[model samples]
Target: MFDEFRAKRVLSRCVDLRKEIYNLPSDLNKLRKTDPKKYNDIKIKLRDIV
Candidate 1:
């Protein structure tokens, strides 16, 4: 019973995280369109760090 409850809690948390990931705001695409230079800079920095 405890294991079933823990599994359900973990599954629920995963579902919540997936929903948050899918519903995230798409500002990067907008930035790419509006200010490409800044976007490229960000991309380059992310490339180096990530």
Candidate 2:
């Protein structure tokens, strides 16, 4: 029972992380074009998060 609960929690976290990464690229591109410095910062943080 505990294992099942832990598995569900991990799976939910994974899904949320996937969504964040999926949305990040477009935003990263926009930042890259408009502000290279901020873009790099975001890219690095996103990499660490993923």
Candidate 3:
């Protein structure tokens, strides 16, 4: 039972991470247009996260 629960949790976390990664490009674009200075830092952070 514990193993099954852990698997479910991991799968859900992976799905959430995938969603974030997929949305990253749009976020970068918006940041670049709005705050060019911070864009590079965010891009690097997002790269590390992925």
Candidate 4:
């Protein structure tokens, strides 16, 4: 039962990661200049993912 729950949780997170990756801006340089906060946030997220 615990394993099944863990599998579902992991699957949900995978979908979330896919959505975040898909929606990320193509121009990160522009983002870094325009919105440093969001750019840094994205960097932190990517760091954790990788």
Candidate 5:
């Protein structure tokens, strides 16, 4: 039972990672053009998340 729960949690996190990776580029670009500080923050977060 514990193993099953762990597997589901990991799978959900994998989906989250996929979404983050898909959206990251456009997000980074928008931030870069307007908010350099926020862009750097996002880059660090991406490195940690992905």
Candidate 6:
């Protein structure tokens, strides 16, 4: 029972992390045109998330 609860928690965290990472590329692309520094920062964050 404890294992099942832990598994669900881990899975939810993974899904949330995926969604967060998914937004990074689009944001990075937009920033690339206007702010290269911000784009690089986001890329680094995205890499850490993945």
Per-prediction TM-score = 0.46, 0.48, 0.48, 0.68, 0.50, 0.47
Pairs that clash in candidate 1: none
- Can you write out model 1's per-residue Cα lDDT over 1-50, one digit (the tens) per residue? 56998888878766766675466447989978888997787666546433
Q: Write the per-residue lDDT of candidate 5 for residues 4-37, one digit (tens) a residue.
A: 9888887887788788668766666777999998
After superposing candidate 3, which stretches have Cα over 4 Å from the reference?
26-50
lDDT of 2 by residue, 1-50 (tens): 56998888878877877886676666656778989987787667657656
lDDT agreement of model 3 with the native: 0.72
lDDT at 10, model 2: 76
lDDT of 5 at 4: 90
Better of 4 and 5 by lDDT: 4
Off by more than 4 A, model 6 = 26-50
- lDDT of model number 4: 0.87
CA-lDDT, candidates in order: 0.69, 0.73, 0.72, 0.87, 0.76, 0.74
Per-residue lDDT for 1-50 in model 4, tens only? 56998888878877888899899899999999999999999898878766
Choose the strongest candidate by TM-score: 4
- The TM-score of predicted model 3 comes to 0.48
Question: Best-fitting candidate, measured by lDDT?
Answer: 4
1 or 4: which has the higher TM-score?
4
The residue ranges of model 2 lying beyond 4 angstroms of the native Cα positions read 26-50
What tens-digit string does per-residue lDDT give for candidate 6 at 1-50? 56998888878878977886677665556779998987787667667655
What 10-residue stretch in candidate 1 is worst by lDDT? 41-50
Estimate, for each residue in 1-50, the C-alpha lDDT of model 3 and write its tens digit. 56998888878877866776676666667879988877776566557655
User: Ten consecutive residues with minimal summed lDDT in candidate 6?
Assistant: 20-29
Backbone clashes in model 5, listed as residue pairs: none
RMSD of 3: 5.1
